[model samples]
Target chain A: MTSHPPAEGLKVHVLPAPFDPANVTLITQGAEALLYRTTFLAPSTPAALKVRPQKPWRHPTLDKRLTRQRILAEARVLVKCRKEGVPVPGVLGLDWEAGWVVMEWVEGWSVKEAVRGWEKREGARQSEQERGGYEIEGLLRRIGEAVGRLHKAGVVHGDLTTSNMMLRPLGSGGAGQAEESGAGSLEGEVVLIDFGLATQATQEEERAVDLYVLERAFGSTHPRSEGRFGVVLEAYGESYKGAKATLKRLEDVRMRGRKKNSKDYPPAVLLLTDLEGTVAPWPDECDSRTMHDREEKRRVPACLQPYQKAESYTGAGSNPYPPHAK
Target chain B: MENITLPHLLEHPLQVCLFRNVENATFLRQQLLDGNTKFEYAFLDASVLLSRKHVLAACFRAINDMLNDRLKSRNVHSEIVFSLSPNNNISESFRRFGITNESINVLAIKVGGDAAQIESHLTANVKGQPAVFSDEVLAEVCDLSRIKKIYRVDVGTKSDGEAARKEAEAFVLGSMALKGS
Candidate 1:
């Protein structure tokens, strides 16, 4: 599963009105955004809040525009899925201007962690030949069905990793026990999450790429069950009306390969540099003390001068959301 | 009177009273139109309400907006009525969800008011039999066809039952939360 260090200074950034900073727990800091667990509406009701911080490396206008657009797009897709009766988190609340989207927290472990945990326990108890059990196949089928429903709703999860899908425990408030004992049960409904890169597309190629991404994720993450990956496609074929056509397109997606250079830098790093400009002086080829004096002397590289001016302009001038802005 | 401290906004307790057959809705609506401070309660038409959760979701939205200083309506009480709407039209929301002369079953709500005072005021003003503000009572009073029409929910495919009601409620909450987005 994807993991990152606990956000050191995220509380300061996230603790606005309504949300208590102490109540916010950093769940994961992915490459794109930070996932925080916090309460919404009430303390008893949990929510997953995804915050996309400002990117200082990019032009501030472009950064603000992208953040607002992406959050709204994700929220729109989730609202669409919920309306279509697809199993996904409902959009509880969102602030595109502030760059946060709060979603109903699905209670369960990720499919990756669950399946791997199950495999480890089962392997310890049984023979290697019997490792690929019916439970594993059942879980794969559920994943396929969940993806099929998502595609049927005319949405494609651009990054379809096993980690993005959660297996929600059947009964309410049973997540703790389910994790302790039935962690490897392969039961419960599969609920999809993390729609950061999701888009509304019904194209066969897009659908194929979605499945292919999952296939690659399953193979890389759970090699013990790699042979049974076909079961996922098999069940997916029966999920919706045109699922079979999408599966046929998966072959072409596979042949063309999936590795394309995508923007992978975390926005936090970009934005942080904008604030401090600590890294800008690195290419000056000066010693630490001299660099400090040189920085004050306006000796910044000609290439870096424009970015320095943009950072200051964004810092003191631009307000992304005006007073009356929605 | 039911004093409900909705989940997040515990600071803003609500004084709610549901009536089965209100006779003075016209007077109550007139008081609101005149901006009388005494009639500051949200006088909602119960026919449009679906369940306790439905009412609570609207309350949550209004209170949340109040907290955020983003209320689109005149006050929290009117904001509560507006919150039930699936669209952004302010006056249209008041017309659809707010009390009118013809409204019989009424759901009276007052935010941050004394429960006893609000209850007694509602009882004296509204000539209606007091009813329990429960889902069962709401189910009986709710005009489902009118609700689906107002919200533009396509009920043609959904079979009539508790499941369908729950689905509709989910849609309503989603739409309310997404208002002005």
Candidate 2:
């Protein structure tokens, strides 16, 4: 599928080296990042390359720092999930210096599309009985299990939306079968995607908020299937040992109201605080021993250490010969 | 020589040759150490290789790094060997994946070389039986114990063979992609 045209002036910046600009297709543009469906390693192996473009409005140093932190944070979380056997995309490759990450391209439709399609078909047929049947229940259960697995792994997807979750058909099953089965069938494994806003937290309040966000997403996106969302909670409650407490906390979160707007805080700032601790106090000082010392404690992977150091020293300094200049 | 153009890099074709029961491994290592231009190739120990994908992943990484001007080693040939390693140490990577005196099966790779020239060069330098560079052949020579040790994967006893191999491969690819980070 062809992606929407990228915002003005972003076309040149988002393209990485070694890839012909002709081959890169912009999949979607979000506030913080642009999703491009491209090939990685080989032309045959499709990958989703998310590029956090350098924000011209912000200070160059701050922009670079945030871009690096968010890219690394997302890659780290995806790697952690893959190792733990969570049904998330494997991180294929990443270049923090370029502000991009290439992940395994999942082949399927989003849960939002599938659910809406199902609801539309069911509404037309007035099949209330089939609506609450095993097919939909199974889908909800899988969604619960996937989310539970994420939480169990100590990660919370800060933004939980149906659009962010995909319904990947299982084991060689064609997408044709999923489409043929109608929207209500709910056939396929629920795979979570777009962990850009995700964080590593096991706190009850955080988990509750995560669930509440999904609940709100479900209610707004698929009102017809709103009644069946409880099935998701039922399966989630039994997914892990701590899930029960998180469910109990969800009640309190609902009463208190979901007030925190992720948009209020700079995405990079939120990601940095979540992944590491506080942002380095001195953005200007090239040698922040405390920053490096703290990062070292976090076991910053060997490959990323150099970039971290470079970001500290250079901090938004213009490249002597930028790739685009060539 | 089996000349193949990997998916992403159509311009830089690779000439590959596999040899089993190699007797001249020490001489091959010496040639590489002396920086002989003709011997500029990735001479990998086949026992450490899991499959065609395993070797190709390293090749892909090396070429990708070279294209991005991010070579951490001397050249793309050395970078290919470094790509196989899960850690960041360059010499350690060469020791783990590159040719050694004790290497019994060798997978020699030369990028962008004449197919006939590479085949003749490989034939003259190595004393071994030429083997088809295929995953099936590599499977027979691959030492699971050594691969596990090098990659540090357990492949737990309870898991079936297919599942265990898949798990190990997933871990290996993840490690390769995250080698420096």
Candidate 2: interface RMSD equals 2.4
lDDT of candidate 1 at residue A257, scale 0 to 100? 67
DockQ of each: 0.23, 0.23
lDDT at residue A315 of model 1 (Cα atoms): 52
i-RMSD of model 1 (Å, 1 decimal): 2.7
Off by over 4 Å in 2: A1-14, A126-132, A173-185, A258-326, B154-164
Report the C-alpha lDDT of model 2 over B1-181, residue by residue, as the tens digit. 6887775577888888999999999999999999998899999999888877678778878888888899999899999999999899999999989999999999999878788888998899999999998867887888888888888875443225556665566667777877676
Checking candidate 1 for backbone clashes, the offending pairs are A56-A271
What digit string (tens of lDDT, one per residue) describes model 1 on residues A1-64?
Answer: 1245456774434433455555678788977688889876556668888888777688999998
For candidate 2, the per-residue lDDT at B156 reads: 46
